[model samples]
Target chain A: MAAHMTNAHRRFLQVLMSNRITEGSEARKLHQHCCETDKVYYAHDKLDDFISTINSHLQPLFMQIRKGISEDDGRAHYAVVNLAETEVTKMASDYTEMELELFRKTMDLIILSENGFASSTDILNLADQLKTKKMKKKEAEQVLKVFVEDKWLSEKNGEYTLHTRCIIEMEQYILSYYQDLAKKCNLCHSLAIQSQVCESCGIGMHLPCARKYFRGQTEPRCPKCNEFWSCDTPGVNRMGSQT
Target chain B: GKEKANELHSEMSAFDSTAFAEDLLTFMGINRTEVEETNDSEDVPADFLPSHAWQKMGEEALKYFRRAPTFHYMMGSFKSESPVRKQRIE
Candidate 1:
């Protein structure tokens, strides 16, 4: 028993030492990159760009660490930390890209619906419908407000009318946002009922869930798939039995 | 005996008056201001108020304003007098 305890202690110390070394190396590299670039790489205003740059450079290093750690009976602690951080970084990047794309698409939808702005009421009604279907109230409100603001609908004397441009804009934006949201849901390992397909990525998911995750009410990444989603899509339905 | 009785009567009369005054104040509901004044003078500590009081106050204020007459008018409803019914001459 004494010998076994000693062996275990030695193994623990070895693992700890290896982890410290790995962490030290990663920290050094990040520091060097920051110094060489002189551009505050990690703390830059453009988070998406920074995240992508880091991932592209650091992914291989993380894989190598993982390979080394997995070889030992006692998994290397630093390797796990590195893997988790990388996943988190990837998710963050994906979410930012999705959000930018959603905004761009929403703007385009507004421009297209500029003429038939009278249909804003219909869109609002649709928003209400979404709410009744268990879509988050705030999410529904935001999407509806975006449509109204885009001039797809005109409000006069407390009545809403859909603008011609609004219709086209709504259609295009909704289709794209819905599709991308779905794809994000899939990436996050969500089991939300698929609603729409992204023209760009061919993904689907519940709109309410997407909204919840985007608003920071829930974890920013999908719990299952760990994928990042754009915050712009309201009413994203998350998969799995919600506790 | 008469002197002692008079002193006791005087004391009872003063007590009755004080009780009557207190009852009158209560009936008139005029003691609320006095109570409020006393409370103000006591200087409650900042933490004495319930933690959620500010949030509740804000919500209540919002609800109150939402039900105000001007709010209804601003929401596009016209304030108009009802039409009078015509009565036949008896």
Candidate 2:
């Protein structure tokens, strides 16, 4: 199907199919290329045609992003198509024991506290919390080191938050025990039923809805949750399942 | 309460937050340069927050999260989201 698309149209589709939600500067790029008949918006007309065609093909996967969450810090957010969420339901054993422990620590912190990101200080302090076979502050730091290196969690601007990969991959584990999923998507009105669920607060929008929300803006967020809609569509992630 | 504090403090020497990030940088093969670190200062005017210092260090260590680990994922379809004890198609 991509064979027929002009180079401009293909480029737009490549960015659109990205696992990451269309938001922030990425949102601007999409709109710039899809709208504005001027040469600045590369495949303007062709992108329109492509979205219309591919939107329905991937609808079951919530490929269209029509909504967004805006945060208090002043940033736009868009939920992307979490293509891996439904494939596996648990943290697969592919991780080493130490890796698993770090993942658990993040989960504990997030679930125990109503807040989303786990401050690095609090996590390192876990060494203090441990009474037995304790991780030296060095060991504790090592644990976090492994986590950051592995993409289980992400650190940005001095805060550590569970990556969307971990959140969506571990949604069952994260939400099943704690956190209520009461918020609903304004665009689709669906229960934010899938990976479109918010990381900070439980809210979401279909991928297409999120993309559309970013149709022209630099950063469009989920108005209800106020989170910078983000996803890492860098490569394939087989994800976890029950042991 | 006293016991908890002791347990946590006992770990002070074990978890040097700064050292941890520096070491992690090496482990991840990030090009790292040594910076002079000083820990000895003596002048008794009391406005020190030890926890804050540690907290700040913890935040500093988090910048490397973007270079997270990569995994080689395999592709295969699972039969179900739950385990079933039924007959096999094999």
Candidate 3:
């Protein structure tokens, strides 16, 4: 059964399968292997591929991998988390009203902004927009801690970015509950928060551009996805309706 | 819950990309210990179970992983009661 494996892959399998088997020698071997991989993979031209390989192998096992540098240690690190034991699994659904309020502010900073990373100060400053009596910087700091520690957000050098876990686990909620105010126009190449969206294919176009595109079509369709774009909505025929 | 977890275990256990990951590790002359997890926790909640479609996705993801190493961009649905991503009810 192990005939197909190269010696290295077999060694890795031995390390993975060791937890169920024995203690002392296996532990030493596992540590040795981890260090070898760290030196070779992290420092080589294979950085991205090495990360990908680890992720692909463990994803089926329900392991979540993250890259971070702890502020306390200031050393870069990679972590593997068990999804079943992780509090991050349903954290979005478990948000308190206050947490959700802060999440809204975070959305404005990360998703609605030109760049994805938002400084700690930006998150704290957005607290002013909250309807609550006072949104002090201390409160934002605490909320950011919750977000980072719980793995909902990934922080680097005091700038926070969305994690892949959040994207995968919260796909539907984000698509349905929130509008992408930062969508860039395909034609004009600028943010088009108010663009009409195609429900079938989920693309956006400026209403004026859509109107011009659909001018002569008896059955208008999205140029990108070829999905039917209905013109029946309010005053869709108003281009020549004044006549 | 037990049934869904079992189903997930069955689905997940069918594909092993560790060989491919290890191949890349070997190619880089990195003799890493296999840190790949082998099983999902039996206590996984029903709500946390992936959609029924994940079985197929697992196969596809494995296929992609075997050809190359990047599977991070592959998406799996976690929507509750979503039409295309309905979780196994039973």
| Candidate number with greatest TM-score | 2
**Model 3, A26-111: lDDT tens per residue?**
33455457648644332334433444555576666775444432222223334344444233343334455555667656755775
Better of 1 and 3 by lDDT: 3
Question: Looking at candidate 3, what is the lDDT of residue A87?
Answer: 39
Q: How many residue pairs clash in each candidate?
A: 43, 38, 0
In order, the first chain's TM-score in every candidate is 0.18, 0.42, 0.37
Complex DockQ, candidate 1? 0.01
Q: How many clashes would you count in candidate 1?
A: 43
Whose DockQ is greatest here?
2
| Model 2 CA deviation exceeding 4 Å by range | A1-10, A16-22, A34-55, A59-74, A79-97, A114-117, A125-159, A162-243, B1-90
Docking quality band of candidate 2, CAPRI definitions: incorrect
Question: How high is the lDDT of residue B8 in model 3?
Answer: 78
For each candidate, what is the lDDT? 0.35, 0.47, 0.51
Model 1 chain A: worst 10 consecutive residues (lDDT sum):
A65-74
Q: Model 2, B3-86: lDDT tens per residue? A: 778867856548778988766554444533333255254453223234355555566776856543322211111222223322
Better of 2 and 3 by DockQ: 2
Docking level for model 1? incorrect
Ordered list by DockQ, greatest first: 2, 3, 1
Clashing residue pairs for model 3: none
* lDDT winner: 3
